[model samples]
Target: MKHLPLFALLGGMISGMAQAEIYKYVDSEGRVTYSNMPIRGAKKLDLGPAQVISSPRRGEGGGNPSSASRSPTPSDFPKVDTSTQKQRDQGRRKILEDEMRSEQQLLDTARKALSEGEQVRTGEERNNYQKYLDRVANLRNEVTLHEKNIQALNKEISNLK
Candidate 1:
């Protein structure tokens, strides 16, 4: 009866060993491959004995595989207090608003300059009208640059949470 029990155990062990076979291969590019099913040129890898690790089943305290692969956030990471963050945001908004106002003033002045340049011709411009046109163009570009700056500042302020 004892011999019968030993024979059954041996048979179970043999079946488990057969099911645990793993094959390994290297491709032409030197990348290694591992698989349960044998490939044409794969060699059977003898990994001694399989190690079994028992874990709680999913829905019973064991985390899902996706959660397991994610790294846990560290407890000691720096965090800003809500009030301080709000204050910083307000300060940034104020600075952007001030800059936007300055840009708007500069844009107004540039537009006025462009208008005056278009209306009046200088001594040099009387010889070549292109000179007056070029001055007007430069003034227009300055106005455009300031307008763009104001728009960017407004966008930044609007994006603040």
Candidate 2:
């Protein structure tokens, strides 16, 4: 029901474009309406002469996908020399290697913490073994997370050219 006005407006626009007659009306509730068909208390709307637009024909406007894909880069586009690009790649490799080293250190620390945590025993945990298990599980998760980080860093370093 709420879309009636939008539909009416579109209908009026389409009819107007076709040089067909349109009508406008305001009901007792003061809601405005537009339509191609006449109704009681509706007034003829003067939507002037139809407007025409023509689309470009085929390849005239870069519309061919094959030709577009083969288009050369613009003259003003920036270009990086082979040496500069190689230096950038080398720098990226160095950064990735440093990150891999850092992640390896973190993984070793996490593993040590998990190992120590697994061996510890407490009076409270003796009566509630689940608590101890939960603590060790958290430590294990930390170690696993660090290991995954190191693996990802190694993969990233290996990918560098």
Clashing residue pairs found in predicted model 2: none
Worst 10 residues of 2 by lDDT: 62-71
Q: Give one digit per residue, the lDDT tens place, for model 1 in 27-49.
A: 99999999888899999998887
Off by over 4 Å in 1: 1-75
Compared with the true structure, the alpha-carbon lDDT of candidate 1 equals: 0.86
Q: Candidate 1: lDDT of 35?
A: 85
Shift of residue 140 alpha carbon in model 2, Å: 0.9
Report the error of model 2 at residue 119, Å: 0.7
Question: What C-alpha RMSD separates each model from the true structure?
Answer: 17.5, 13.4
How well is each residue in 1-161 modelled by candidate 2, as lDDT tens digits? 99999999999998766557889999999999988788799999887777996655666655764465455789999999999999999999888888888888888988998899999968889899999999999999998898888888877877666
The ten-residue window of minimal lDDT in model 1 covers 64-73
